[model samples]
Target chain A: MRRTSPISVYLSLLTALLCQLFPWVGQGVILRPDFMLVVILYWLLRSPNLCNVGTAWFAGLLVDLATGSLLGQHALTFSVTAFVALTYQRRLVLFNTWQLLAYVFALLMIERVLILLLKLFEGNENPGFMYFWPVITGLLLWQIMILLFGSLTRPKTN
Target chain B: MLKGVHQKLEPQQSPAFFVRGPSPFSRMVFFCALSVSIMAADARFNYLSQVRQGFIAALHPLEVLANAPSEWTRDTKKYFSEHNRLVQENYALKEQAFEQQIKLQRFNTIEAENTHLRTLLNGNIPIQPKAILGEISHMGRDPFTHTVVVNRGSQHNIKAGQAVVDSKGVIGQVTRVYPFTSEVTLITDKELSIPIQIERNQLRAIAFGEGNNTLDIPYLPTNVDIKVGDKLVTSGIDGVYPSGLAVAIVTKIQQNPESPFAKIVSTPVADVSNHLQLLLLALPDYKEDELSKVAPIETTATKKELSNKNTALIKNKAKANAPH
Candidate 1:
C-alpha cells in the first residue's frame, strides 16, 4: 500500500466538503451522496491513526452548519459511526471485498438511522423512504474509493 | 552507513499500530457528549446563533464558488435567448406596466381618502412598510424544512422576523440573518404560523403549517364560518405581517365527527418554486418610547381600570372573609 500523509487526507476531505457544498437543485439533492461521510470513512478505515472519531465529528459539525440543521445533529451520528467502524478496523484486513462492502453499508445505514431519529425528535415530518437514497449513493462512492485507492484487504504477497 | 541510519530512524518512530491514541469508545463518548450539549444549547438557549452566523460568513467565499457554475449557466442561457422572444416579452411588460400605472393612479386617491378618514376618527396612522427586493439564492440545504436563502441579509439591514412575499402572495418570514444571506422560513414549514382572516367575512384565526405543503387551522368549531375556496389574507393582529396581504386559499375543510374542531387545510398562494425574486418587507416601527410619551393619558386610563379591578377583587375577598 502506498504511504499516505495527513495533508493528503485533509485535502481529499476538503474536496469532498466542496462537493457537498455544491448547490444541488430540486430532486438532485435527494441523490447526492454523503460526501464527507464517505471520505471520512475511507480515511478512518485506511489510516485510523491519522483520522479518528474526532475528525469525523468535526466534519459532521461542518455539515450541520452548512445544512442549517440543529447544530450537532450530524456530528453525533458521525462520531458514533466512526466508533463502530474503528471497532472492526482490526478485523478488516481479513475480510474479503464483499464483507468490506457489507460493513460500509452497515455504517452508512447507522448514520442514516441516527439522523432520522434526531429529525423525528426535532419534530420534523418523516421525509419518507427516499431519505435512504443517500446510503445507496454513498455505497457507490465507497466502491469507487476502493477501486481508486486499492482494496482495504491485504494483498496476497509471497 | 545510510542504511544503518534509516533503520535506526524507523525503530525510533512509533509504529502506526501503537500510535492510535485514546480508545475509540472513549473518543465516541466524549464527542457524543459534546455534540449533545451543543444541540441542547442551540435548541434550548439559542446561544449558538452568533457562532452559526460567523461560520456562515466565513463560508461565504466557498458558497460563492459553489454557486458559480449555476450562475454561469443561467447567464449563458439568458444571453442566447432569441431577440424575437425578448422583444415580445418587452412589449407585453410595457402593456402590463401601463395598465398597472392606470390602476395605481386611482389607488393614490383611495389611499389619501383612507388617511383622511383615519385622521377624522383619531385612529393610528397606517404604516407603509418599505421592502427590499431579494432573489432566492438557493433552496435550503435540508429538504425536510421548507426554507430558502435570500441574497439579502443583515448587511442590507434585513432583520429577522420580517415578512417575505412574492408577487402572488406571502412566501414566508426571515428566520435567520447572516452577513450576506438570510434564511426565509416558508409559511408551509411546520414551525411557522400566520394569522389570517377570511376575505369574505373578515373572521380571523391563526393558521399553522402542517409540514406537508399545507396550512392547518385547528381549534375552530366544526360549524365555523370557513368554507372551501375562501380566500385567506393576513389579519396583521400580531404586527408581524402587514394587514390584508394575500396569504393562502382554503382548499379543503374536513369536519370529522370524531373531533370537535374542524380541520381546514389551505395551500399557500406564494409559488416558492415558480419564482426566485421576493420582497422582504421592513419590520414596522412601533416605537415603545414614542407611544409611552404620546399616550400618557391612555396609559393612566388603563392603569385606573386595573386599579378598579383590583379593588373589586379585594372587596369580594373581604366580603367572603367577613361571612366566614
Candidate 2:
C-alpha cells in the first residue's frame, strides 16, 4: 500500500474547494461536478485512518458556507455518505478496478439523492433530471483521482 | 510439561490493520444530529447570519483567487477586440445619450410642474432614492435559489432589503450583505413578491415569483381587466421600490370555469443573464418609522405616541419648507 501524507490530503481538499468556488456561467453551472465531495470520498476510501467522517462533515460545512445555502444541509448529507462509504470499506481491498468504480458511482448517487430530498424539504421547486448531471461529472473526476493518486486496489502478481 | 503448555497457550494482543478512532455509525449519528440542529437554528432563528457574514468575509480572498482566471480571460478578450466594433458602439451610445437628454429635459419640466401641483394641494412630495452601481460577481452557487452575488457589500454601505435594477427594469433585491459582496435574490425567486400596477389600466395587485422564471398574480378575478400585453410597474406603496419602474409583462393567463381567480403569469423584463451591471437603490430613510407604525397595535398609548411623533415631524418639515 502506498503511504498517504495528511498534508497532501488536506492540500487536495483545499484545491477542490477552490474549484467549487469557480464562477460557472450559463449551462456550466448546471453541469459542474461536486468537487469537494468527490475529493473527500477519494481520501476517505484510500486512507480511512487519516480522513474520517469528521473531515467530511467539516468539508460539507465549508461548502454550505461557500454556496450560501441553508447551513448544515450539505453537512448532514456528507456525513451520511461518509458513513455509508466506511461501512463497506474493509471489503473494498478484495474488489477490482471495475467494482471499485461501481462502488464510487453508487456513493455519488446516494449523496445526490440525499441533497435532492433536503432541497425538496426546504420548499424548493423540483430542479428536474439535469440535477443529476453532477453525478456523471463526479464519476469522471473519480477516474482522474485514481489516475493521479494510484488506485485503491492492490497490484496483481503472477 | 503441563505448566509449559499452559504458558504457551496464553492469548496475545495483536495490532489491528485499521485504526479508526470511532465507529462509523456513531460518528454518523453524532454529525447528523449536529447538522440537524444547525439547520433548525438557521432556518427558525436569526443567530447564524453573523456567522455566515464572518465566514464569507474570511473566504473573500480565496474567492477572488478563484475568479482571477476568468477575469484575465475577459480582459484579454477586451484588449483584442476590433477597433471598428468599439467605434461603432461608441457612436451608437452617443446617439442614444442625445435622444435620452432630450427626453430628460421634458421629464424635468413635468417633474417640476408635478411638485408644484403637489405643494399647492398639500400632498407629500415623493422622494428620489439614491443608487450605487454594482457589478455581478457571479450567479449564486446554489441552483435551487434564484440569486446573484454583487460586488458591493456592507463595506460599500449596501444594506439588506435594498432594491436592485438594471438599465431595462427591476432585477431583484439585496437579501444578504457580506463584507465585500452581497447576494441579490432575483425577482423570480419563489420567496420574493413585488407590489405592481397594471400600466395600461392602473389596476393594482401583488405579483409573486413562481420559481420557474415567471411571476404569478393570484387572486385577480377572471373578469379583471388585464390583457396578454399589459405591463406591470412598481406601485411604490411598499416604499422599497420606486414608483413606475417596469417590472414584467403579462404573458399567459389561464382561467377555469370552476375557479373564480385567474392564473396569471408574466416574464420579468430585466434578465440577469443578459447584463452584469446593476444599480442597488438605497432603502428609504423613513422605512423604520413606517414599519414601527405598521407594527401590530400592542398598546393604544404607544400607537398614539408614534402617530403624534410622526405628525410632529411632518409639521416641522412643512413649516421649514413653507416659502420663507
Candidate 3:
C-alpha cells in the first residue's frame, strides 16, 4: 500500500475549501454540496492516522469562517461526524462497495441533521426539505472522491 | 522446532498500527467542548467580529479567484450583446433623462420653498445623506439570512447601518462591514424592520420582514384604511432611512375575526434579483452640540409627541382634501 502524504491531504483540503468558496447564485446555492465535509470524511476513513478528528474540526472552523456562519457551528458538527466515521473505519475494510456507500450516506445525513438542529436552536426558521438536498449531492461527491483517490477497501487477488 | 523458535521470537507489535494517538471519543469530546464555547462567545459577545474580519480579509484573494469564472462569463456576454439593443436602450435612457430634467426644474423651486417654510416654522433642516455606489459582489453564503455582499467595505468608508437602495426603491441596510466587503441584510430578512407610512393615507406603521420575500405590518387594526395596491414609503422618523422613499406595496390583507390584529403583507418594491448596482446612503450625522442639548429621555418623549402630531396633521390634511 502506498503511504498518503500529509501534504497531499492538506492540499486537497485547501482545494475543497476553494470550491466551497465559489460564488453559487440562484439554484446553484441550494444544490451546492458540502465539499469540505466530503473531503474530510474521505481522508478520515481511508487514512485515520493522516486525517483524524482534529483535522476535521479545523476544516470545519475554516468553513465556518468562510461561510460567515456562527462560529464553531460547523466545527462541532464536523467533529461529531468525524468521530462517527472513525468508529466504523476498521469494519469498513470488511464491507463491500455498496455497504461502504451506505456508510458514507449515513455520515452525510448525520452531519446535515446536526447542523439543522443547531440552526433551529439558534432560532432560525426551519429551512424545509430542500436543506437535505446537499446530502444527496455530498454522496455524489463521495463517489467522485472514491473514483479520484481510489476505493478504501483492498482489491481482490483473483 | 519451528513452534519453539516462533515462541522465542516473542510477540512483535508494530508501533505504527497501535499509535492512533488519543481515542476518537476523547478527541470528539475535546473539540465539541471547544466549539461550544466558541459558539457561545460568538453568539453572546463582540470579540469574534475582529477574528471574523481578519479571516475574511485573509480569504479575500481566494474569494476573488473563485469569483473570476463568473466575472469572465458576464464580461463575455456583455461583449457579445447586440448593437441594436444597445442603441435602443441608449435612446430610452436619453428620453428618461430628459423627462427627469423637466421634473428637476420644478423640484428645485419646491425644495427651496419648503426650506423657507421650515425656517419660518423654526423646524430643524433635514440633512441630505450622501451615498456611495457599490456593486453586489455575490449573494450571502448562509441561506437562512437574506443578505448580499457588496464590494464596498470599511476601506471605502462604508459603515454598518447605512441604508442601501436601488434606483427603483429601498433594498436593505449594511449590517456587517468587513475590510473589503460589506454584507447588506435585505429588508426581506426577518431580523429587519422599517418604519413606513401609507403613501395614499399617511397612516404610519412599522413593517417587519417576513423572511420569505414579503413584509408584514402587524398590530394594525382590521378597520385601518389600507387597501391593496397602496404604496408604503419610509416615514424617516427613525432617522435611518430618508423620508418618502418607496418601500413596499400592499399585496395581501387578511382580516381574521378570531384575531384582533389584521394580517397585512406586502412585497418590497426593489427587486435585487434583477440588478447588481445599489447606492449605500451615508448615515445622517447629528451635530455634537445639538445632541448634547437633548437628553436621551427627553428625545424619546419628543419623538412620541412628534409622531402624535404627525398623525393629527395627516388627519387634518385628509379632511381638507375632502370635498365639502
* TM-score per candidate, chains pooled: 0.88, 0.90, 0.89
lDDT of candidate 2 over A48-138, digit per residue (tens): 9888999999999999999999999999999999999998888988999999889999999999999999999988888999999999999
Order candidates by TM-score, high to low: 2, 3, 1
Write the residue-wise lDDT of candidate 1 on B51-140 in tens digits: 999999998998998888999998999999999999999999999999999999999999999999999999988989999999998888
What is the descending DockQ order?
A: 2, 3, 1
DockQ of all candidate complexes:
0.76, 0.90, 0.85
Error of 2 at B130 (Å): 0.3
Q: What would you estimate as the lDDT of candidate 1?
A: 0.88
Candidate 2 falls in which docking quality class? high
Query: Where in model 3 is the C-alpha error above 4 Å?
Result: B1-16, B287-324
Please identify model 2 stretches exceeding 4 Å from their true place.
Answer: B1-17, B288-324
Query: What are the per-residue Cα lDDT tens digits for candidate 3 across A28-120?
Result: 889999999999999999889898899999999999988888899999999999999999898887988889889998999999999999999
Pairs with backbone N, CA or C atoms under 3 Å apart (clashes), candidate 1 = none
Question: Where does candidate 1 chain B have its weakest 10-residue lDDT segment?
Answer: B291-300
Q: lDDT of all the models against the reference?
A: 0.88, 0.89, 0.88
lDDT of 2 by residue, B1-324 (tens): 999888877775344864566799999999999999999888776568888899999999999999999999988999999999999999999999999999999999999999999999999998889999999989999999889999999899887777899998899888888999999988898888888999998999989888879999999899999999999999986677899999999999899899999999999999889868999998788753453343211122333554587789999999999996
What lDDT, from 0 to 1, does candidate 2 have? Answer: 0.89
Give me the candidate number with maximum lDDT: 2
